[model samples]
Target: MPELNRRALLIGGAALPTATSLTPASANAPNNDEAFWREIAAEYDVTREIVQLENGNWGATPRPVQADYFEKLARVNRDTSYYSRRGMGRDLMAVRDRLAEALGVPSDEIAFTRNATEAMKTLIGGYNRLTPGDAVLYADLDYDSMQDCMKRMALRERAEVVRIALPEPATKASLIAAYAEAFARYPRLRLVLLTHVSHRTGLALPVREIAALAREKGIDVIVDAAHSWRQLDFSLPDLDCDFVGLNGHKWLAAPLGVGIVHIRKSALSKIDHDLATAPDGPDQIGERVHTGTLNAAAFLTVPAALAFEARIGLDRKSQRLRALRDRWVVRARSIAGVQVLTPDEPGLYGAITAFRIAGKTSMRDNGAIARQLLERHRIFTVARDGVERGACIRVTPNLFNTMAEMDLLAEALTELGV
Candidate 1:
């Protein structure tokens, strides 16, 4: 579609800028806050045909990153040997270092993975300690992939898979108590997986408290920051967890295939997952290099994403997202038979929200509702799975998303009479 428009303009007028017009002179013009984000959004090329509210799944990368990613691919294709031998590994790693610096963690403490799933599997799959009756505790709301991995370990090692429900209208204390209760149920609990921000309902859990409590019980914690990285503000040192994993493309606005893992230096020796060795060699911590070749462009463009964030600032972005979310909540809760499953507590939720109609259908039926919303209203959303609640519609918005989009969603959802 961008190409079609580009061609149309060429036929009658000056062609649309192919991101080449974004010179320093242009970027330096006036106050950058609004213009910066607007420029980034303009690059996304999201069609007017649908309102995308499911960024918890994945977000289309920004134009700068997309262009950079394609450039890296072209570079590789341009000269395979020169790119592979020298230009690929170390040069690309400078970008990784920059990513680590942005996260406030040491570069050596960071490693790239294919996605959050790979990071989770690498961090826990070779945990190196699991006795019979040993346990891995998790909430009912943890992502199905992580839970599935835990259950697989349960089947193979005779380990206990302790599950507990998160308290609704969650508070830091309530979330702490929830994990405590689950820990109390299993005497030999050895690990606890906490989703820093739940994918289904977009609840940003209190990771610091949860990790501190788990530490008291001598349990290892691996925080899934899949949504937390961009959806909420987080600092690694403050959380004090053993490991953290995140998806770069979903919320971070980086090119796809750039995921992150941070293993506390002390804990690296204890973790023995198989990944490619970084050029520095295996004796070093954060020496992880994925075996397969990866693109340097998307990984490099992380700096562009961060620069864009610096322009908008996390606080202002959070304000915009929360305001959008609160608007949806007001519209959703007003409808009869609608029950918000996620907490309405401002701190507990970011840009994500979910609600079910009373006795209308289970959360599993959410996919049906989501499909209907899309087919009928051109609103794109996702239905969550693998929970006691039947199904739930998950909504997330990026910086590009506007209140107008939310209004469209609200009108369409209210029309469902749910």
Candidate 2:
């Protein structure tokens, strides 16, 4: 196996690592070397019977991380409350420190939650700065639960709910313009929910640009970065948002039930404390979210997950994912009756991409397409709705996946597209 030189990693256009930087050996070595990626694929234990492309729900924990998690689980089972009451707090804090460092934020500004949904709920529900007649905005592509929460928050605060539709076949300029238009149309907008990566269409939004637009209008932005954190090579500072909800299990490949809530230290007071009493007081980020009796093993295994990713390097991981996505999307776009929903523009997409067959906009139609791919082609995918345009089949490939698998998916879609 070829050894990866850490010094060769360099981030380039649209935040993706340059191809030359990804070469493991001499400059002549191909960035997308099949032999090197196959070695990386060996770290995961996936089924051989099927091509698993639907990895967006949650990532499969790497073998090493899984082993660490099992060990922690057994230790917690043996010690029970004796361990929980004594050293668990300290251990958890250390985990938070490591996570905070990875995310480029202070340890005190982040807290753990069961998942991104819980963290987002905390940020959206606990936002207490709204006044009567103020408005909160969300788009069709935002998570359904988060949108519902925004509506409920509006009702509670006597604020208006401004729901908008993102433009289909969107461009970077159009996406930014859409938000700017919304902010202008709703002068009283107090808050907006921004999904850094739309789960429905796999559309990667220009978060920092959109957040900047929201800020000019004095609207607080709560970013749902559930799918973007490790999948994209970016840090918290790059987003420039005050609050964000991140998922560890998704791209980080951590054990299930681990998520992160980030509230910038300067903006901590904007979000009210969790309903549960905070013994640590209002200033502490942990007080902002209270999920009682979390899965200790899952939380304990996060450092191991981070370690595995560090070994591979986020720049390489992200570039490899995009390469896999492009392998299929470029072919799918040329196929008859297929519409690739996510744009190929740099920084506009990542590993996750969605496509729709001609005239198959209904949920049932897309669902059947997903089933067909599974049953006939032995490939796994998911049907997603809630896009303003229509339903689509979402394809997300993990680090374990190979170029051949992507090619197989494209061939399957060609057969089904007709």
Candidate 3:
């Protein structure tokens, strides 16, 4: 239950890097070298028996962050009661402050949650503005749980639920047009759930434009940016929405259970505070969600993780992930039957991409391909459904992954018979 001293943390020799010292020279490297990334990969302790290309699920922390997490976990375990009563709250708020600074928002406007699901459940369900007969909308590409939350919100409000399909071969124009048409069709729509990046196909939607469009129609947009925030080079305000749910574990490389809920101060009035109580201030962002007791150690590890990411630099990280995706996708497209699901546009994707053999759109077929990639080629992947057309095998490469690993996946696709 010790109070965290910022000066001490900064000067805590070998424990946390200083503000100016952590930046790696390679952050500006012009070439992607196996040796260069291997040096970075050394910071991870993952198994090399299989090439892990499924990092979209949860980002693994680097060794430095992991060590710090373990140390803090031990400290919390040694004096649970003392830490919980005296020190935990202060440390938690400090983490929230760091998160706010990193996210370009005020600390009071953000709150920590167990994960994106918990945050979205609180936000989508607690939103108090909807009334009977008003419609809420979501797309096929939105996360399944979030879509479910929107449906439940609709049911609770006696409001109609409107679902739409995004355009195939998605382009900026097509994406905008499809949403515009849906808005015209559902004039009573009150809320919309937009995924910044579709987990199913790794398609990065133009969220800023879509949020603007929704605003024009007098609709509030709740952005599901769990997959896009750290994976892509952008900030919360860049999405131009008042409500957003973000995942720290997925892209920020924080511990497994950290996520964030951001509510613009002006928009705070729309979401009702969860578990009304004196401590749960009606206007406080933290009051919007109730997570009984959380892992203090994991929450404390966020600053370390943020430092690691900043040292590497987001622009460098973003460009590298996209390059890795393009590496395999370009080669896969040359195969006779393979179809890359993500668009080839520069800004349309990040580390994740999904693909299927021509006509192999069923869940079973896509699952088989994912299994084959693991069993036959020793390359890890996942089968994803919920896209408008069908299912596909999703591949995501992390910072530790090399081009050789990506080529192996591309080669495996060419050899796998549909």
Candidate 4:
């Protein structure tokens, strides 16, 4: 087994409350609006200057969660004996269980991983358990990490990888049928790795029906929920995938070094026990994934982040993100010759949106657009210059951003005529 490198200091010198005696700004009720977010904004100490639109890249830890994490860390450092002797792993899981409750899944189904990449890699790497000649299916629109892992499987395990292009700015039926056709063609495909939401185009995959259909085909599915958790309000039962890899840092706004992997209870029977010897309860999924000596601080603080979202609530955050996307899209699309690559329908995208900009009709033009945005505008966004869409820009919005900031982005694109 490769040694898992420990994480940077997630815990520092700070004080944590005895228990989370969480207080609402107003104990009786909370208002869900820009004002509410502003009040709670102090919880996360963002860097001094710059509008951060890259939560999709890395999330800054909130003040309360970071402080609590560091305080526990200091306590552990003070008496390594006291911390190590008492079985700290047993204690930390009560925290994860609380997160499980908030996520609407049973405690036994979720496991902790550092990020979605690790979680997805583990699932793809373990193809040794799969039947011979079993295939893996994905798309050109997926995060490159999973696509690369699939390539590795082909090299090592002799499994075939089938890649499909999501219909440009797809509809629910077309998206579902795209995968259905792939599965029907390759009945030997034992597993499907689908993104609940695309990291690249901000496209939302129709997972529920897809999951049901795959089950009928005897192909287990693993969902990448990097952009889905807290982006919308729904339960694990709703999407119904066999396995899911979630990033707390993205939408949940948790501190870094924490991610959750939930294996649907029905699919639990297929995973081998003793995968890792990390401590967990009798039926807890933590035991299945826990590698020794990880920072449990991020895992513990997720509830705080979720609590923050709960105060603002999921529906409102989602609406806010959609509204923000709409604002940016309208501005960008208004520029002559610009094409909004992301779907306008509410179901197709959220939190992230991408647009094809007018330029030299090449990927290089896309790269130039991204570089110009950052160098000139001080606005940060992800850009891609690959395959179908030559030059494109990805815009993402979070709770902390304001309309004025997005207007600035609009102004930058307007100057460029793209």
Candidate 5:
């Protein structure tokens, strides 16, 4: 591992500035749009050994953010006592406030966690009001760990857990109707778990509509927005939910081990304070998750990542990713034995999409396909299970990915008869 020295990087003009100072070149300039995005991609030092198409799992920190992370880590390691006692607390809170502002939410409503999994676990496990016979609902597309947490909550509360498999070739109406049926079937449903975007198939759910329906049915929803927050062109409020779990590393391009938990002001009472910090009171969102000591460097580097994203603008990033996905998906669909898991409708997906070879429903089969893609084509992808229909190869392209790379993948899939 390399340690960064702020003096060297800053003096060399390679260091990125603060969010207030960094501004992207005007998009109005003609014929330079692609050039500008390529400039953004240049900030990363990815290798050519393999083309990475599994960025949905964890987005590697770009050069600028990694520099900041290293600098912060070195600083913390050098002056551990002083920074921990006299400096870290204030800086951490400042990061929180900046992040909250960027998300268009209240600062007090958000708290930092290790990742979306821990944030979600804190939310699901600490929600203590369920009683015997109360029901909770979750879909097959929900993250596996979150579904397990819901099941544990059900067990602890002596409640019934309702699990449904989302319909294939899902449409906006069909997605919403599935939740509606779940609510109707289980009238006692008190809490529902919704994934803003499905990790298995890259299907972006209609969270706002589903949240509203849950509210109408007297159900409080805990949203797993780990994949959607930065990948999509929206904010927390857009989902119309009181609780959400987000990942900074996935699309915000932050260092790993960074995630967020948001609890609305009015909904604070629904979650029980974490046992480790129970005495701190339930009003503060931080009390909901008692993470003792974490990698302070990762959280400290968040501002740089946010500044980079802010410079590019979320909407533009989203559009670029959608175009990349469309580039490959549109071509891949022409091949035989190919099934695109994500719907072809607008606003239902972004860069993430999955594909399957006909009748390949087993994990081993999907894994073999992913291996072949990597070994034969030098294209890296991952196999995802838990989709009711079958396992699929998830393809995620980041900002650094080029259309040529997607063309290579299309060629590979076509060659494989998929």
Candidate 6:
């Protein structure tokens, strides 16, 4: 393949004749205007081979960000340890500062990890306040790894692990009530894991309300915002949680292997330092988790991703994504034998949503349904399990996705529903 086609295929899964060939939108075009979105879509090199609705895994870095990543990768490769040991620290700190500004947190409170999984692991394992007989709570919607970490910590500290099931068809008030009830029922609950946006069904939880409830009960909440930071228009303060784990690759469109760990300055004492010592003192947030070496190129490319998101504006991006989500979900809900997992209420969902055909609740059933959608309709989706009720098929669209693709998915579901 030619160099242009090669890069396009590598990043977007297909070659575009020329990304710029698409007509530009008017400067005054409304945010929801398809022409405006098409212009934004032109920034990415999307595959023509299939309708991609599985963007929840990770975002495809825009061409500009990808170019910046390649340049940084080349520089790192050429400079090697000489640059890494001497000059890279300053550059890394610069990236951290920029990311901190974007997240509305102090630079000292946030640390970069390979991904949210590593970030949350450091927070969960390093948490030192738990005591024997005290309870640490999590819900069925929490990520599997974090759930396991909570269980392990409970085992190690002799604390009780309390698992609750979030209410289905959850509303803002009902969601808050669930946590309030949990907190009241488990008086010994010292810590709780809250997922801002569930990876299983894309149910966006009211983290701020739930955290406030936990706070009133003297419970500390650690939020898994791996899917929410950029997917939804919010900041760390908006969540009201002192500790959070987020991802850049999911919605910020940075290269893979970039994640964040945020521990409020005042709350730092709650988490112990990593088992591995660092040259930096224990007072610094960087010492919380020592991953040793990371993809310096990926971390360095974050500024470019932030810059891209800045130009588009996070608020506008959130609206655009929600519009795409609602476009299909409205149709899918009306189809007989189809069950929409996430509610239609505002602030409860984003670009990610899930659905299942009635009577198809097993992992095998949903997996087959997802495969059939791909094979028959060329619409791609993923099967998700562990939603307490049963398995589901998650559909996630990114900035590059067209509204028509969501309709294709709805149509596919309709056919499958029969």
Q: Which candidate leads in TM-score?
A: 6
Winner on lDDT between 1 and 4 is: 1
In model 3, which range of ten residues has the least summed lDDT?
A: 6-15
> What is the C-alpha lDDT profile of model 6 across 1-418, one tens digit per residue?
1223322342335433334323434335678776666666778876766778899899999888999999999999999999999989999999999999999988999999999999999899999999899999999999999999999999999999999998887898999999888898988999999999999999999998889888888999999999998999998888878999999999999999999999999999899888797546758778898998899999999999988887677888999999999999899888999999899999999999999888899999999998898888777899999998899999999988877677777777788775
List CA RMSD, all candidates. 5.0, 6.9, 7.9, 8.0, 5.9, 4.1
Q: How many clashing residue pairs appear in each of the predictions shown?
A: 6, 0, 0, 3, 0, 0
Q: Per-candidate TM vs. native? A: 0.87, 0.92, 0.92, 0.85, 0.92, 0.94
lDDT value for model 4:
0.70
Compose the digit string of candidate 5's lDDT tens values, residues 1-418: 1334321231243432223222345444332265455566667777656778889888978887889999999999999979889989999999999999888999999999999999999889988769899999899999999999999999989999999999899999999999999899988999999998888888999999999999998899999999998899998888889989999989998999999999998999899888887574656888888888888999999999988777677888898889889989999999998889899888799999999999898999999999999888778999999998889899999987777678878999986673
Task: Write down the TM-score for model 5.
Answer: 0.92
Query: Which pairs of residues collide in candidate 6?
Result: none
Residue pairs whose backbone atoms clash in candidate 1: 276-289, 362-391, 363-390, 363-391, 364-390, 364-391
Q: Which residue runs of candidate 5 sit more than 4 Å off their true CA positions?
A: 1-32, 278-282
Candidate 3: where is the Cα deviation over 4 Å? Answer: 1-28, 276-282
Candidate 3 lDDT: 0.84
Candidate 4, residue 220: the lDDT equals: 82
